[model samples]
Target: MDVKVQKNLLCLSREAAEFGPFDAILELEGEPDALWFYREHVSRGVPCIWRGAVAHWPAVSKWSNDYLRETVGSKEVSVAITPNGYADAVREDLNRFVMPHDQLMPVSQLLDVIERKEDFPGICYLQRQNSNFMEDFAELWKDTDLDIAWASKAFGAQPDAVNLWIGDERAVTSMHKDHYENLYCVVRGEKHFILLPPTDRPLIPHMKYASARYQLDLASREFSVVDEKDHGVIPWIPLDPQKPDLNRWPQYRHAHPLRCTLKAGDMLFLPSMWYHHVSQSQGAIAVNYWYDMAFDMRYAYFQCMDAITDTVAEGNCCAVGDHDIEDEQELSTGKT
Candidate 1:
């Protein structure tokens, strides 16, 4: 690492430690007005929780397993399958970053796997983030509003995508940042989030890993890692927030991670470009809205900082300017 770049990172780490939001995420007992949300949380790029924000939504109580089975059971849905319940995460065993094997199956079958009613070969999660709620699960639309009126008004537009999430306890979302302002609501079980503000970017490490995918052998109930050489290499964070290996990535010791749990009916406002890792209780169900982020001065500054971090970590200053930064939201659904 270049001495100047290392010094810059050290300075950033100190700044975050001295002046960052070291406290817990601000919690609001009820929903706030659009303008207040825009000014306090959105514009400031901070996270806050609205306790029981969506408690009134009928889906909170009605979207149970029986309800889902009766509604979308027959419909085929896209499911991300992995042996370890990690989709689009760096797998140290394979020494590569692997993406889940997408499988199409009936909603009932997927529920069976989640409910442990059947002995499934792999961990299954309904985490397709391409507006799957609006596009695929139309039957459940009436249960929840299409858009959050306050949030839409605050953002000055409707969400670009409304994602539906349902997964097992083991299904963990790796730590990463996204380009969209996210509003996440939990309707079923609980979701635990470990969040690090964008200011902590310098302390977080990034590495390029070989691209790969998981493939399952049904008859033998075995899973194999397949390399995707065509896709070349991909950059990913190898650190596990639950148990970060400080020895390998020592800079991470300076990071301050704020933890929060969103239970049924609670909503979380996750600002754009904030690094977050998520875990859930068994059969946790949630929905989230992704609003396009403004590519203004803040984004430009973040990009510049990202470039510097990459240069310091890799000893290749040109690496950042040469490649387009991959959209973290596109590859993963845990933007919240």
Candidate 2:
């Protein structure tokens, strides 16, 4: 379609309306697709995601040469990829964090390992603050294929202990949003992301802020975010962030979902407090930058803010880095 690029423009009410429902993007393929695009042979409809992204994926691959031009099965298409299977397979090879072997190993020498992957395994984590990241964060800025200079403008202060996720199609996360404004970007394959505005967040089921703590305890692998807990599955419950269950906490339902997708070279401007969910379609891979309010909030000056910060970033890890503030103060302080 007609993808328009605007500079220094404010999203008018109509232009900003894309946030209410989910959206999808397609075709922007590139080189990496060659390495990761294995012949699935299974022809199926797309997926049940709200929005999907597919930018810069490789059009061809060395391995794909064998099955080039071959339709999936009896049909004209080519692969039979099971989304759940794909998600499981991708989680196999990714390092929890792939922080450049170049900084530690020089680029030319390690190019092979970087270019050789059957599928993309995703990476996710929580880390402490690094001051150097603000001034001239080389990796995030110098290397990003997108407008890092423009993208970096949206940080208040960098967060100390914030959640970070990166990966390929195999790195599919369940559709969920936390009490945080997210910065989602696609460096590799196209990244499909969906978000819920604060008004819709209550529809997302949540647990006591303290009980789930990253809800899916990665340490134990108890990834039950919604519903109630059964023996092991943690029982999936639909938590409406806007209208919470009084029986449970009686104060949930306030959150909403406002979602979208980001192709390679694309960036998302998430206001604090917005809830989001994402899935990578086909050969898409991506990463995200999440900021908690304890973060530096100066970037508010750039993102079309008519007044002060309207959406406060709040959720599970609300005041993780605030050494001086007590838990009580953490809950009380939100975007003003």
Candidate 3:
């Protein structure tokens, strides 16, 4: 058999034997100690949900629209506005990967649009991940913890970024992995996640496209795609987990996706380098802590696998930091 064909068969076999065994994400009733968390989930690269992890958090009960308005309504914050709910996703019509139009608005105005009390021309999301909870919404910090105690102890460091996310139901996070161990906490509504482990990287397809940004014309309430002429190109996963086009990307058929819905007060320990696509209920609010992934043997091994997969997939090199739109201040993209 040919080398590429052999690699493909190997991936299929691995999917059957190794990947298919773990059909569900482990859900824990109470918070585990740092040692238990590391041994069971963190060290092994397993994802788990700690039910009612932050149920006692004041934010869970106090973070209503009226409360938010009373607390931080007048504050000016960054919002990602897009014609469609998708920010930082492949725009098939334009044949480009586009970022959302970043707009500055008061917290009150953003809530108005989310609540449908006021008619907004475009979908607005406060999904900026640059520690927005600490910097932008500092006034509301008293409601939630600065960092998860056990998680910080297990990681042996403070969180690099604590992000706040509040958005419309249509706002979708595209499939991508991060170089950080993420602890995502839902405060208001439910968030649905479609997760694929790093071991299944061989089945995922990546494509390179010219980068663009959404430019909104407030006067006419229209969005235009503006090409990033200077930035050149970016490699992104164009596959939508909700509707995987198997014909175009057949390898995706071999991928095993674990679906989980995180309701209010739930915290999901999303391991590093796991590809995920996320969607949320309307007016959902969330906060996530990103701890930098250790560049250890596991990371080096992953790089080797990534290189081999790319080589076997017609020389498609895995783009490092391409999907690092979480830090939009440094990276440019519309979605997280």
Candidate 4:
């Protein structure tokens, strides 16, 4: 991008952080009224945590490792296996965005892999997002709510999907945005989230990479990235928030990141289009409801911003003249 455009983008990010209501995530002692939730948080696209909101959930206490092993141990379910813990992330080594190899295995065996009680060739994660909890683990639905009552009422519809996540610390969810408003509840252990607002889109680098998948070689007990020529290229964020490369992505320096940890029984209201990267404690379990976001003016404005960013990134737009240098200097200096 042109230097002037980059500086302006940086300025926009700074202003967002400065003008935003809370520097850190706001925590609610309890659930708010459905009208308040929709009016304040959902409509405004703000994130908040409801402390111990799901504490009364039966799964929070009953879904122990032994109990899980006893309840659904013999059931065959899909598991994501990767050489490294990252399931769906940019594999810089291969210059491709690789997805984990989906393997079907018994729940008991998967638990053994998670606990390190058995030798496994790859890291294992049960992270199927296709409403796997409802589809496969129907036995466990009795332990948790089918849908958050307040959330459904606020969204004016039931969740499109309810996902179950069971993974260890090694499994990491790469930074990305979703199109659905999310209600994430931690049932066991802890979940760490690094969040960024959608307004920081210009500061975050989005690159196109070929799609690939990890395939394990049973004979060699190894994994390799196999390109999916038919899938074509995918747009993804390459920058890692934990260890950012400032030299390549200098605009990210101006971006603001909010960090929050969700303990067992905690729930986070993640607004649509917000960027989030996640990591979890060993054997952490979570269930999240995805409600489709409204295609309102907010989304329309974001789409416009995204188009402008793409144009700026491609250097298709003309640079600001020398007369604008003073304004650029002011932006860089954090001056009005």
Candidate 5:
């Protein structure tokens, strides 16, 4: 099939129009039953918001600055530091996909950086995802459940990792997808997410960039991109959803994006493989459960789609770092 036809079928505008305003997103009033939740949302890979789902968790009420300082203050934790707050994102100027420089700092010091009480050179974000909650912050585990009951039931497995996120307002998570079904719960402040469905993979351009990491010189307080010679080229999406350069990535105009904000006590069910970019209110604190996704038929289909996308990209003579192809026409006039 032609690319246009494929794009149209992928977007499914006729069905979306029929759904009307609901096409924006689905919101759940409260926690859902396992069977119904799996059948309606999880099975179909649909995203939803569960308002006040974890409102009753003790952390939501007791996790004030003083409380956290008194509890886990002196504990040294891993913190991702970046000068531009764009950790694990494409550094266009350097032509590389750069990772943040991770440093070990006391929780109290990290909080001070986030609160602007300490004048740190780079943005500090405590975003270690290696089950940090169950490890470094184990003392605070009494405040919240180890696992989300309904979500664990729906996924038929416990979370592979539970991560705690505390970051400055400038710390931004670049557009990326994960292989795990994610349940992100905001415990303090708010988080804004820009989500794009996986079907838009073709429209969303991907380029291979050299892998690098930001390294800060402690004495100079300056950051430098250090290339990881062994890591090779990393495929990443270069477009920034917040300020998309439509002229360069004009095909992205055909993609549709959903925007949502999750306040404290709210939980977001972000399905596996859904591309998302996230930013947060200053001192935003969140916990996310990563459940391993089943490598079932859905995953198989996505792999097939991904292979087809690569084939199309190759046929259009799209280079490694540049995706724009003049010979390729616009597919759909949906939304940017």
Candidate 6:
């Protein structure tokens, strides 16, 4: 879990081994030369262990659950009250308003109604109209801003909006990807985020799964089925990227998967287009926020036109994106 170099360590490569993956290692353990390289580079990607992250704030500590629940459940209001005042809850909501409705909004009418707070006399049933909760929230990340990291303020102008998220064991966002960049801060309790890269759009074959191809039938409030095959009986095949489990999806080894671990004060940077999955560790948690605009996101642009959410496991296949993608390729390749 340790990334920094300890003293008496000979040759930086020996120290960097702890991080795994020999693709491109950066051992900055007390190395001024290595640290200097990152500062000068553009589009930097570095995973630093828990260094100096902050604790939860009164507002966040006081009511993060209340905020996410209120926002996700409410059919209206992109901005919410954060005990402090009116503020943008997420940049994606704003982007939803600005982006063409057909391109992003889950519901078209939702956007038509989202005029600036100045004009629309608070919609009767909306959160702002009926609730006493504060409308503004401060960004979660105020201290750990790295120069190599993307300029969140420039892209998102996310000075006050929340970029970080925290929740209890109950916090669950049914498989879905956000339109904005994310820096996860794990403080307390446990949260699990399941993620798939953008290229692997097939994984979101079900409503239970995240996908771009599946269109929402607002009138029925139901998902339109894309494939005729009863996924319950047969499993889809997928290419594995990480340590392939042949007993599971043998093909998984072929697929390049990216995983991460974030402990207390541990922050994770998700560059645009990278599919992510998160699981809250069991413990106390805290995090800051930052957001960026204009990403060539994989979802909105590339639809999940085919079924791909199927997963493999203890002998069973579920239709709603939970099928075992039996990697036939694994057997042929001698991986299984």
Count the clashes in each prediction.
Answer: 0, 56, 2, 0, 0, 48
For every model shown, what is its TM-score relative to the native structure?
A: 0.91, 0.35, 0.90, 0.93, 0.90, 0.38
The per-model lDDT (C-alpha) reads 0.86, 0.30, 0.84, 0.89, 0.84, 0.31
Quote the lDDT for 80 in model 3: 95
What's the CA RMSD for each of the models? 7.8, 17.6, 8.9, 3.1, 4.3, 15.0
For candidate 1, write residues 4-23 as lDDT tens digits.
45555555545655554556
User: How displaced is residue 106 in candidate 3, in Å?
Assistant: 0.3
How well does candidate 2 score on lDDT at residue 19? Answer: 47
lDDT of 4 at 253: 68
Tens digit per residue, CA lDDT, model 2, 123-218: 321111232223322333322333222223433344432222322344344444343344455544555555543333222343212112112232
Best of the two (1, 6) by TM-score: 1
Would you give me the overall lDDT of model 1? 0.86
Candidate order (TM-score): 4, 1, 5, 3, 6, 2
At residue 64, what lDDT does model 3 achieve?
96
**What C-alpha root-mean-square deviation, in Å, does candidate 4 show against the real structure?**
3.1
lDDT of 5 by residue, 197-263 (tens): 7776766888899999999998998999899989999999999999998777776776778899999
Best by lDDT: 4
Ranking by lDDT: 4, 1, 5, 3, 6, 2
- Decide which is better by lDDT, 2 or 4: 4
| lDDT-better candidate, 1 vs 2 | 1
